[model samples]
Target chain A: MSATTLTIQRVSPDAIARVIDDAPLEPFGLTDAHRRALAARLGAITTDHHRRLDSWLVERGGRVAARFAWSPLAARRLLGSGGFRRALRGRAASIRDGVRDEIEDLLARAASGRAHRGSLGDWLAHRHPAELALVQASAVEWARILAETGATVTGDWTVASADAYYDVERARTTLRARRDLLVLDGEVVVRVRAGGPTPSAGPGLRADLAAAAFAHPDGRAPRRYVGIWPDAGVILAVDGTLANVRAGTRDLVRATIALHRQGELRAA
Target chain B: MTPTTTPARSILEDLRGDRSERPPRDIETAAGLRATLDAELLAIRSVPARTSPLVISASDVTHHGDAVDITHATSGRLRGALIGQLIRLVAVGHEIIDPFDDALRAWRLDSPSPTLIAAYADLDANGRARLATDVAAHAASLRRALADVPSAWAVRTAVRARVPLAGGVVVLHDVVDLVVGSYCDASSSTVLLDVTTSPIGRSATSLLGFHAFVHCLRTSVVPLRVAIFSTATGELISRDVDETWLELAANDVLDVARRA
Candidate 1:
């Protein structure tokens, strides 16, 4: 077929997942090229370093991560004095304190555009496999859950190439969110693990909600955040309470820094 | 390939011909057997989902033997996943190198044993040497089986099956090691194979039977044959899924359900 006359067919991610879950003997039936494509795309797609650190924070603070993160008392006090942007900026401080230098160093490097992936890989190389496995396995199972529920996405949720943008309504600042999976009823931000003591909602989902709130022109945000373990088939959902968001943002800031410390931003 | 049959062949081909070794399916007897099987299925479905789904695996049905054997057998399973990756590559037509190098490369991006790459990296020289030799040998055995596999056959690896019972309250679930060809019970259109790293410390034939039974339940069709490849000894045990064979599998499934 002529290139102009040929119509390109794009399979939606949901369609791809549906085919997999429903069909018992599909892989063998598809063309080799399609099978390879599906295989490559298989597994949990969300499990970024920043997300993992937020997960780590969920471990440290447990419920406190939400109480202090969603809308911290201090951030609220700052908001009374300044605009929403200033309050948001104020929220940054609580998070930066625990992990400032690492954040500045890594974010600056990413901003400089040295080699974000190299940064990601160096960090992954040092991490124990269990952590990565937990992240990946959980991601895979979460995908299965999404398919089972017949959830659909309005935008591309593909990782590796996706750039999530979270806008701060008050400050007009945009926070980039690269989450694993986002279910957009009111946005269920999922962070999955294969094996781990299932902690309650972590900083990753909270930060996502925080970003969504700031980004929304209407100031509307995702209502819930999730921490999932696929192997255990366990899910921990925490509501988007203001206090939890404040704590989550705080954890998010620290995680942003930790990822920088963890990653190496140089060419392979 | 999945459990589907083509119209070109007959589902009852095995039972219809006088050339068959297994006894023919007698309609009257089969009718009675079907009722009994359905009753077992209903009994299985009777258990509440809260009491854990009535799921059983080929391994669960297989005799694992005594403790020392069990320990050895268990450890061997840990490597099956890693080795299975190589077999998968072979299935998809990849040229495999030495076990260590190919495994290191293929598993770098994706592997169930997420830390295996690092664990391999952490190994001392002798440890590394031992691992490489063992993996390379196993890889060679799997490749031999692949060579025997028809290129035209559809090869599905690590195929997961959940045969819902009692209307989804209970399930008979398993991850079939590998399934080849398309399948339908009437036609015996598909072939299923399971690969083990070590020699059979236990009679893996029952495991194959479980695989056959699950396939039949998941897709109302019987597989033509179920086989097991012992990579350690390069031994393959295969059984044709006759009506009699499938009936025995039904009995086994019911046995588990009755105990449950």
Candidate 2:
């Protein structure tokens, strides 16, 4: 079991571009135009999320919704497909006013179904209830997604709690062996550490949690790393802001650790 | 008689090469010129940010023959240095309302002989004297108009006399987007015309249409010269510019600015 955790970094447009370029879509005969359009669409959605999330944080005064709004995949599904064309085909004509109205109607319809579920308050409750500031339904969802990929995970993990008032701060404290709970299936495992931080009315709690996770221990460690695969070779590591962390950060940590291990082995 | 050599033909060429060797008299004078140049650059750069919201008709004549009327938007710091140089050249010594009537107009006009040059020379050095004083006043007016604002105003003055050319007409428009300065500022003038037409032939015959327009501005209307820097790229990318459309748009913008 590795002591350290995985760290998350802010995402950049260039990094996202590289990710898109490396993805499997390259083997197929997708045109540069198509690739560009997809990348642009993803970038736009990410930008919207960042902006809305920051504003939501400011307006709500540190109360974050659990689900982190819509998933990137869901955004792509809803907006990137031929849905716009299908919705507007028969209704709009050459008449400017008619076309505008039809377009508006189509957008309204599309926005109707998922609007309520995507609220910040509800998402936060789902992700982290009053019981624990760190664990949330979104984090669970991420763990499940990782598990389904057949990664090795150490389940029923736990950690030590302290006077820390935020998830980020509590993440820095070392977890006691007995109080922690670890759950593992396939590649992903969840470790719930007891007694650290509780949600407080004070400001900057989330940011603290985020910093401690990346810089401290107790979160995004070996379990999070090897949990990405069933075979469990390279250890992933990090601390804090598990869900809504920059996508693919776990893999980055795994790659970094793996390179370090290789160098060690060669030296030995 | 002052010993005179053929003055540089085009101020645009000198500026383009970073050879503005004719330095201002003092530090304050040079600083004034620099400040005005900077303001114009800012004005040009602001176009992209402002126009980013507005849906405009864009065309790339270099690649496509027709215009692509789409509701595309963009925001960035656009490059206007090249275009600004050309503009400053056109603005050097023209009168506030009648830039083309000044002795500086000789820079672009043909002077075949010494006799011809003397005939049109500044008889009393009035042209040289008027240039500095008039330009200073104009600069002051421009400064006042552009202060405390992200946008400026402009006016479209007609060009008088027929230019022997073809295809499209070259219109001379004013370049005042500031309101607080003198009534007329000597700025670069836009010679709007379709570049596809040859300098000779029937297409060039309408070159003189703007000459009368310039005359109108000198007398009744204030002739203004403005700088317009534009670059179009993407699926409809092109190095070629359609001066006719730009001229029309400039005219429209000028009217709007003056009225406001």
Candidate 3:
């Protein structure tokens, strides 16, 4: 781990394009040992109690509510889905039209009893037009920001969905991870943020990458993680190496302890 | 009272420059301007390390009109805040039903102010009626001036740009009311519009320049123009973003930083 080097670059949008395009393809071979090691580390933390940890919990420091609410997370879920890709591809007159069509489809699904209650579709159905307009506006801005990064839905690039890893011994303890987009069959992971870079961004991103590795079905870790902050016009690319993943695992453990302390305080 | 005669053109039409006239793309010039501002700001000792950074807004650079006692909410301030929300609704082409209610709902959506809500609750029947009348008049004026913004231009409301300088010690923040068009690398095409309830004042130009400056630094693409529309008097003022305006804005920021 000491011999491995972790590369992180903070650059402009255009330069980030080059960074993503010019990333070195490193060989990643993850065996059951690696998966077992990660699981063991997480399971050790949740041994005392059941815990569901995700990048948000590890990075932002909070408890995940039992129910979904209207927040940027919902927007992110839509942005990183195939439905949004289809919406973008539609020959709509305007971005708002595309978004409206997407919402209408969701409404139809909800009417047909396909969508779960308290989901984005269910929640949006009860919202006012003014609120929906705001959603449309968000979709438009996100689309524009993504386009500025020279990222397209075509080729090997596909929107990545959230992945979860449950503890073998503790079924209640799970680790969920998600990235905005991935390409080269999950070798490269991309996450888009709303604002500027922060002091905690690097560690947070590393933890995300680590969670992705733990939850990956093939037990393979990504080679790179690219974070794009459109509002701040900054991009961060971090290499995924064994040493870095170990460091990220440490971050996750610390965050889990902190969360447990908070929960204990609430109980007290 | 509403204007006796309708204007020949809407405020959006007046501010939306010719689509054929593409501003020249000078990435070098933009980069140089940003470098200059960064250097000037980096030299300032406005905020010390391990301390909360100083945030400079347009109001910090120039006089923000006559000061009112903020401890107590005034009808004028409430009207202004509502009008601002109404402009946001209009920018997104939301249907305006019951100007006062729509404005209040929009305002609460963006910022839920308990004090303002309490203030509104305290308003007597006559006072509430007068406030509603004023908001309706302002809504009419806004509608008359803004007309219908085409959805194709991708209008964004309350677009905020916060550019940190001097290693995050000093942050320049500004929010443009309405942004039209997209950022083009080949040429400048984005237009920023600021909606004000009051008549255009002397500091309007400075505010516009400050917005343009912060936007350029944030997006790295210089906007084509920055315009301000006054719903109070149906006045519109727009200026093409040039090196001069950006320099002036930088100086204004430096002045504020020096004072800090």
Candidate 4:
């Protein structure tokens, strides 16, 4: 009687933007005319803040079924942790305005030499209990949603601590292995929070993302990466395959870091 | 040699004003009793003014991350630190609405009162007839409860008597129980005694609050009696506590806080 786990994909900001742009704006089971009218209204503010408007939509038979707004605070908190460092550093471009300030604040604090000598996750935990609670709740929500989707999880999803350095990658992969569910091969949805790096599709961004992924708590090799600012309705999507979820999560995290680094370079 | 004149004066005065059932026990005449009280006071005073260990239950555990969770042992340590600090604050006679805030003041932990008094004043449904009277009564109660207890004199009296030092139990509708703890005589230096109980309004938070109070006594202050009562149910439970090791523990807590 294991619970179902969600095999989530960190969708690139660009791809996410496109999906939001192209999606028919209507509730789950709208008529053709109603969907068309709603689409027209949604198409107006669909460019920059598209990901903020982007939500989780479970599709069945070409129809949007269940939808939930990704928590911007939760996503940003994840980005601040060592677990999301790779995804954060992977971004080669810019993100939404709202998230940009928050990410910058965190980065600035880290750059100011206050970052923990150990892992970022430890730093976040010690410094931000209330905010981190939201991130934890979000992770739990992800597990709950996957369980609801009928994917039986074989093991629990967990983040390895700084003290448990050797088991980093194995930990993330375990989350996906829960209940013996197939790790989805297709695009995994990623909704960036407001306080993350901006989106850009550039070649150099990949290297920066790899570097950030290497620094993540999972500490795995990089693959495809994506960045988004869901709060601002923007997404930066890249395509790649990781050896496992740990590697993938790290690569995706790095992409965000790269974007922030770029922003720092421009400011300097 | 002077018994005929000076001692006769006391006998004559007693005969004229009052009657005695039996001769009073005099400390000067009773060498054993005098020696015992002296030893008890000295032992308490010698218990370096600070340090007490904190005990924690199992409820504080929670999951944190993958392969990470909060443990009861850690929580106990934290609770110890928190209570130790609170004792130090209350010892120095700091008046504060929040005990947590009270501990924040520097040098406030030097001499804290063993007994803490808190008051809640509620308006009665007097339709302008006895409004002033009710209001004055509430104010008087508040003044008495929060009155600055410069020392643990009243607490010592209660402890010596093994009774509620706050006078006869004043049970409240909202309060389920009340507990009182204090240091006593040679027999029970650190004793906890239950004072009163109500039949309703008991909760974990209340128990924890009293536990924290004992924690303060055990660590940075004195041998204490801890009484716990519920606001709703009024059931009371008490423990005569011996926290003589608090002095060493407070040093550890200080070191930890500095590092943290």
Candidate 5:
């Protein structure tokens, strides 16, 4: 499988802007055949056989899934919440100073019969001052990194959705699309990770690129896919090219096939 | 009588140092040290490959006295862990609401150990009260030390540095309790601070060196200084990072790696 070239660098905090700005501007256009193949491959993995494939089940894959808790960790949830996005929209100084208040508001909302059991708000509602401090500290670090990106404080960035594709016949199984933050009107796709780059980071990021392409509204992938690891002080960028997206698709297909075979084996 | 200086104030003064003193950025030294350590470490017998890399932490280097039983959760160990969590809380500007409750909450959030949880649960009311009182005292000490971390310093708590060496054969992991300043600064301005529940000892100093060494390996920039504040006895120990200090740290790691 042909993979997109990956560039990994240990970037200082101040240099993050240059890395994002320097990302390649090549457009990634998908043909009718590509779309059909993606749909068929995704459909084959669905558990159900009779339901139509509708709506996207979007998710952040690779390190994002491993690092961010889909379950109980309140700090990770707060980082990816709508509240965090709103905080980003406010004055930068307010974000640094008022993180605790934001957390308190989230906890209050969770306690007031608004949040479901085991939700982000529920988990936060039970947290003590020390745990809240972790959330606050994480926010401070995140704000510092975002400030270095040189992006406008207002509506330049928005959280991307995780899309799911189900089998047309049976609606039981679903294939979720991997994505995270969409910046500059989806010109650049960003995945915020926790740690440093690893041996599998290249393929994982390509999978992210493929997932983003599959969910693109225009059938055109973003010009660049960027992975930022704030803790490790590193950034990885991959141009959203045809070969790279194809490689990512191949990865997803292979993974799905393996899972499908496993399910069948279990049943037999 | 003159007013007594608090440990936290002393640490802050030492950390601030001479404002006009700007340490030169020595990337070449860091690179050389990393190359030497890499060559020496790879030359040692490699551990058998496994699914996960073998991790080497500061405890691995410092704990040479007695073989700590992995299964037992001692009160001292629990107190240390609890105090460490509280220090992180104070560093982030969180006032300690209830010391024991906050520490346990932070600990659970970070890593919930069933063994530790069961141990804490088994404690009687009096035992639990004593623990809480101890935690409150430690929290007070920590609050004083970390309360004034200037926002401009860009204080980051629980800053972890994981340096995987020998093609991921062994990973050196260390977490600085607090970091002041940024690596992106023009001068050598980054300062690594560690908070310990126990008094600073010989082992603690060595651990500080180990932290500096691993940090340099990860960031390619040596921090200006490394400091440690002990909540146990209100003691502060600090040392500047230099080529000689890094060399000693590299040698210590080599010695430990060879033994392993």
Candidate 6:
């Protein structure tokens, strides 16, 4: 007899207040204390693992592997514009090992699967010294930015943390998607990309935000999707919509079919 | 399915929302193409396995040119690695090692080509600088391509699919740069993707053609569409595949054999 009209509301950063509680800000309910434990466990990557990876990479690729622990910027500076051997003159048998042990240790955890957040940020490793350095720097910078932006649980976060609150399509569904950070009481979903100069968010990033928001079993959609290029010091905030999620899911489904249709075909 | 049930339409036009339709070619029957491929593979197996005895990738078939453009090849290598990393980042989230770095490291461990390995090991400063710049540019393009991908989708990098042509004697292998979506045993369910730094001549078409038939042989399920993203041009071109198109590609492969 009657059709109720629905009006959409605009989401603003100001609408959400920053939670800066040291008691551990649990957006999706992964207890702050639990997150600290996970972080501590992951951060405690053994020194032996670092030595192994470093040595292994170097042995496989020669000096580039170990020599590349430097950032691209630093590498260019150290590798002055000269003859190849001249550029690398005395670059061998590094009398001084300057590459941070922390970054390497973190990498060891990631490679071992001990550091997988499942639905949070990643501790990605790179082969290029510059790329490796860039990632390490970005992590530090991102930490600083999040601290400045009114969140305390930046180190170990995801949409599915125990402290987090969200709806999923099913109770038994395992979350394969990862969200960078959750704020505004988990109303805002943030995905971070750091390594080089901060770049703009594109279709892929948008699709990711949409999928993460819709898959939320909490039956509630995130108010906003924020893309942060902490390295570039850029923040792109967009209204999260169901359409993007559906589109993303559509692409995802298409990709899956293409990649694994053969196996499924065999099974069928 | 007959043309009555699934009439051929302009797949590229549908995706790009443009009217650049190419005339459809006479297509060979799937059974006939399969027979031809079987016979060729059988003949090859009659002789001792002189060359590599494993899977035959689309690259081997399409990139049969005699002239090896080092720059072109180098570009492809860098682009492939960068794109692979991007896909892994999207699918697995920075879980993989830097493929480029690892590749260089792998080269040292297994020197497939002594000359190539020596060249790399003894790369002059100028050459190395140029390579670094080129690699960075390609890597950036890959990152850009990946950033646009959604996290909810299932993404895989350097995905390998294989099917033996002649009783496992000659295996036709295909390595896709990236694949998005899930494997539903339906015609229009998946999207097969390829990424290239510098557009290789007729590579997109060849890969798409191989993908259509190889997928059918492997899974009996055809992908919904095939796409190629040229990192150099920033173009994502795509086309939907049907039985007719698959037949045409199979015939073209036969033609290559005939000409040879």
Q: Please give, for residues B92-208, the per-residue lDDT of candidate 1 as tens digits.
A: 344565665665444554444645555656668997677677788888767765653333334455656654544444455677666654431123346677777877655565677
Worst lDDT run of 10 residues, candidate 3 chain B, spans B64-73
Candidate 1 lDDT, A2-63, residue by residue in tens: 11110111122233233222222211111334223322322122223223223444344422
lDDT of 5 by residue, B1-260 (tens): 01122553546556757757967655667668866777877777355435676677888777775755321236666777788777666655676778889888778777656877788788899988888887788788877766665544566667776676666666788888877765556578778888777666667667888888887776667888888777777777778888898899888888887777
Name the regions of candidate 2 deviating beyond 4 angstroms. Answer: A1-78, A81-268, B1-241
Using TM-score as the yardstick, the better of models 4 and 5 is: 5
The deviation in Å at residue B67 for candidate 3 is 6.7
Off by over 4 Å in 3: A2-13, A27-29, A47-50, A61-68, A71-84, A109-117, A150-171, A183-186, B1-10, B46-50, B64-74, B113-115
TM-score of chain B of 6: 0.67
RMSD of each: 18.3, 28.8, 4.2, 27.4, 5.3, 20.6
Candidate 6 DockQ score?
0.01
Q: Where in model 6 is the C-alpha error above 4 Å?
A: A1-268, B1-36, B43-55, B64-72, B75-79, B95-119, B185-187, B255-260
Predicted candidate 4, C-alpha RMSD: 27.4
| Local lDDT at B65 for model 1 | 37
lDDT of 2 by residue, A1-268 (tens): 2232233211111221222222222111223343343234333322111111121132244343456344322222222122222222443221222222432344454455432554432332332111111111112222222222212221322211221121112112211111111233111222221111112201122222222223223333212221111111111222222331222222222222343454456569
TM-score of each: 0.43, 0.16, 0.86, 0.18, 0.80, 0.41
Deviation in Å, model 2, residue A126 alpha carbon: 23
**Residues A122-163, candidate 3, lDDT per residue (tens digit)?**
776766666655555556556555545534323366555455
Worst 10 residues of 6 chain A by lDDT: A50-59
lDDT of 3 by residue, B174-224 (tens): 878888766645567778988777767677778888988888777667788
Compare candidates 1 and 4 on DockQ and give the better one. 1
The lDDT values for all models are 0.45, 0.24, 0.68, 0.27, 0.65, 0.43
Question: For residue B246, what is the lDDT in candidate 5?
Answer: 89
Question: What CAPRI class is candidate 3?
Answer: acceptable
- Span of ten consecutive residues with least summed lDDT in model 5 chain B: B1-10
Return the lDDT, model 4, position B50.
Answer: 27
Measured by TM-score, the strongest candidate is: 3
Native contacts retained by model 3, as a fraction? 0.24
Supply DockQ values for each candidate. 0.03, 0.01, 0.35, 0.01, 0.33, 0.01
Q: What's model 5's overall lDDT?
A: 0.65
